[model samples]
Target chain A: MKKKDVLLKALKCAFPYTLPILAGFWFLGFAYGYLMNVSGFSFVYPLVMSICIFGGSLEFVAVSMLLSAFAPLQTVIMALMIQARHLFYGISMLDKYRGMGWKKFYLVYAMCDESFSINFTADIPQDVDRGWFYFFVSLLDQSYWVSGALLGALFGDLVHFNTKGLDFIMTAMFVTIFAEQWMKEKRHFSELAGFASGVIALVVFGPQRFMIPAMAGILALLYIFRRLVEKMWETGEDTE
Target chain B: MKMTLWQQAATIALCSLSTMATRFLPFIIFRDGERTPAFIRYLGRVLPGAVFALLIVYCLKDVSFFRYSYGLPEAAGIAATLILHKWKRQMLLSIAGGTAVYMILVQFVI
Candidate 1:
């Protein structure tokens, strides 16, 4: 196939996987832009930040960081702490993204939760090229976010609709992914450990400080049970 | 904003730089051509299941079970999502249906 044909075919195959993200990212991205606009930053802020940062939670938190006292070091620490989950994403994607040449950089750069989930899980057709499929998925998802941010920043003041619960789209999406992952895997240990650690850390540390501890706990649990988990994967049987 | 334009630019630059660092570090450390360590590979296999669950928790981190609504709306929304997903096995429908249900509950019912 011609390069153009391959690109088009991959884009066509990739579009459906990104549909849900188009909704979720636009809603959340628009809200972030609107919040930034109302918070007194210009539309330029959200436009640039959404493209550059690409990580949703950190972008929202950065809004406050922008408004507060100027502390660049603290901002770096906060970004690292809040966006630390990308480490897991990068580690997981290492093998899958290995041979993409130049596109690997952008794939890693645009590795937001939604894109990662879709790219990681979607069983692409045998005919579709995986690299282009990943590229289009990343590009399309990022575009939805950037466009939504621009729209909201440009028009936030005029809209007064109640979007009180639209944010739940994110939660619903993650829950669905969790369910899908649950059904795919034979052992539920890692999933349960993630849940238990998250809840325990959330209860002990509260929302503001739970993430780091929860991650640490997950690493410890998974590392400690590496043999058992590996056995379960190999045997596809409950090791417990 | 209290900071100068340059300061603001620098702050945003730092934020992006730090975020990309996390995303790129592992791949950098585990370099493509070289053989990846067995332990890291082990993590690559199992972390997705745990990470997604953790992400779900991250999304709901702010919901207060002790508050007025007491997380019932979120609970219902998640329940709706699970049922719709399990029943239809359709990703978009489950997300849209669950979100719509939550919007209604919060907008009028809750």
Candidate 2:
């Protein structure tokens, strides 16, 4: 139908998927903004950082980087290490993200964990425009984050509620997503590899330095088992 | 804030730039119109399941199983989420229920 109708329909379809993210990002982003505030930065810092960076973990880590003495090299290296996971996200989304025209740029830029999960997994209706669906998902998710940051930065100490364990929302979100993926796939090799490699890497490398190693392990395991994995897909085991 | 405003701006700019670099690199390397390698395409299909798993583990990596709370709170939260999800199959319900359970446990019980 009309171009306006296409975007509206996609926006309607996309909003529901972002509701969970609304909660998670608000909680997490509020905390990030609050931290930046108490750490002596202005509200502008969180607003800009949330809009520009958009990576939760890195944004949090950047607070400390900002606090410390200026080390440009260290800053670049840290950003790369914290964000290397996005490379995997990019690789996974390459095909699905094709032919989006200009939206492809913003899609790649806003490819955070939450946005990627929804865009990659959600079964958008055929009538809805896929590109617009993806765009609205990313846009809505980022808006939640930016607003939350602004809220916390502006009024962090004024309201005091027990949000001690609220961060668990993210872990819970990922677990549910993983479970959903598990139910969808016929074979568990990739999931098992991901889990085992992550745990082993964590145990071996420790929490502070395990991400890259965990990623490497996952890639290696997947590579080694490519024949079987491809055969499984070839046999029509993947539901997607 | 020991760094000057200019330095701070540069730092944030560098961070945003580098983060974008990682996010955009793969797509840049494997352009859209050109034929993507078979192996990369295969990865695009299978990586989601594994990446989600990795994300879960990454979120919980900081929990100290051997220390004070002993990760009971985290374990309980995850169990609640999985059970609630499997039972109802509603994303919001599972996430909120698990988060509520964890909040109560941490704020009061634990």
Candidate 3:
């Protein structure tokens, strides 16, 4: 296939997977941009932060950080805490992302939750270029977010409608993805561990600070149960 | 805003730096050709499921069950998503349906 043909094919294959993200990112990004605008910052803040930070949750948190005192150290620590989950994403993508040359850097840079979820799970056709497929997925998802942020920052409060519960789109997306993963996997230990740990952490730590503890709990439980978990996979008893 | 222009820049820069650090650290630590530890390899396989689950919870963490609406909108929206996804197996359809349901519920019902 020609280079253009390959790139086009990869984009074509990748675009559908990102359609759901298109909606989620646009709405959430718009909300972020709108929030930043109302909070006394210019559109440039959302544009720059969305492009640079790229992590949706962290960018929103950064907006609040920017509103507060000039605590650069706190900003860094908060960012690391909020984004620690990307560590799991990076670890998972290690073998998949290796040897992609220059693209590897952007791939890692754009490893947000949406991009990682699609890239990690999507079963790309064998003939398609894996690198380009991953690249377009990351690029398209980011573009939706950045463009949405820009739009919201520019025309946020001016053109307002009832968008109250639109943020639920994100939760819906995650739930669907979780269900999809559940259908694919044989054993449910990891899934249960994730759900249970997250719920426990949320209850114990409250909404303000549950992620770190939830992650720690998940990691600890996974580590403690490694022998049994590995045995389950090894025995293949749960194979569908 | 209490922050100076340079302070804002520094804060954003620090955020970008730390976020990148988390994403890049694992690959940096376990480079190509050098064997990745067995434990890390096992985690790479199983962690995605748990991570997705965590993300779902993260998205809904702000819901106040003790307050008004008591998370009914979220519950109904998730049900719509779950049922739609199970029945049709279409990603966009499920998300759209669930979101629309939540919007209507919160805007009108609740």
At residue A207, candidate 1 shows an lDDT of 89
Instruction: Encode model 3's per-residue lDDT on A1-240: one tens digit a residue.
Output: 999999999999999999988988888998899999999999999999999999998998988899899987778778888898899899989999989999999999999998999998898999999999999999999999999999999988786577788888878888888899998877888888999999999999988788889999999989999999988877665554
* Runs of candidate 3 exceeding 4 Å displacement: A237-240
Q: For each candidate, what is the lDDT?
A: 0.91, 0.91, 0.91
lDDT of 1 by residue, A1-240 (tens): 999999999999999889888888888888889999999999999999999998888899988888888898899988999989999999999999999999999999999999999889888999999999999999999999999898889998888878888888889988888898898877799899999999999999998888889999999999999988888788885532
Which residue window of length 10 is worst by lDDT in model 1 chain A? A231-240
Candidate 3: give the clashing pairs. Answer: none
What DockQ do the predictions score, one after another? 0.87, 0.85, 0.84
* lDDT measured at residue A119 in model 2 versus the true structure, 0 to 100: 93
TM-score of every model?
0.97, 0.97, 0.97
Q: Label model 2 with its docking quality class.
A: high
Score residue A240 of candidate 2 by CA lDDT: 55
Worst 10 residues of 2 chain A by lDDT: A231-240
Native-to-model Cα distance after best TM-score fit, residue A160 in candidate 3, in Å: 2.1
Tens-digit lDDT track for model 2 on B1-110? 69899889999999999999999999999998999998888888888888999999899889999998999999999999999999999988999999999999999998
For all candidates in order, state the fraction of native interface contacts they contain: 0.85, 0.83, 0.86
Candidate 3 local lDDT, B1-110, one digit each (tens): 69999999999999999999999999999987899999999999889889999999899898899999899889999999999999999988999999999999989998
Alpha carbon lDDT of residue A164, candidate 2?
90
**Pairs of residues at least 3 apart in sequence or in different chains that clash in candidate 1:** none
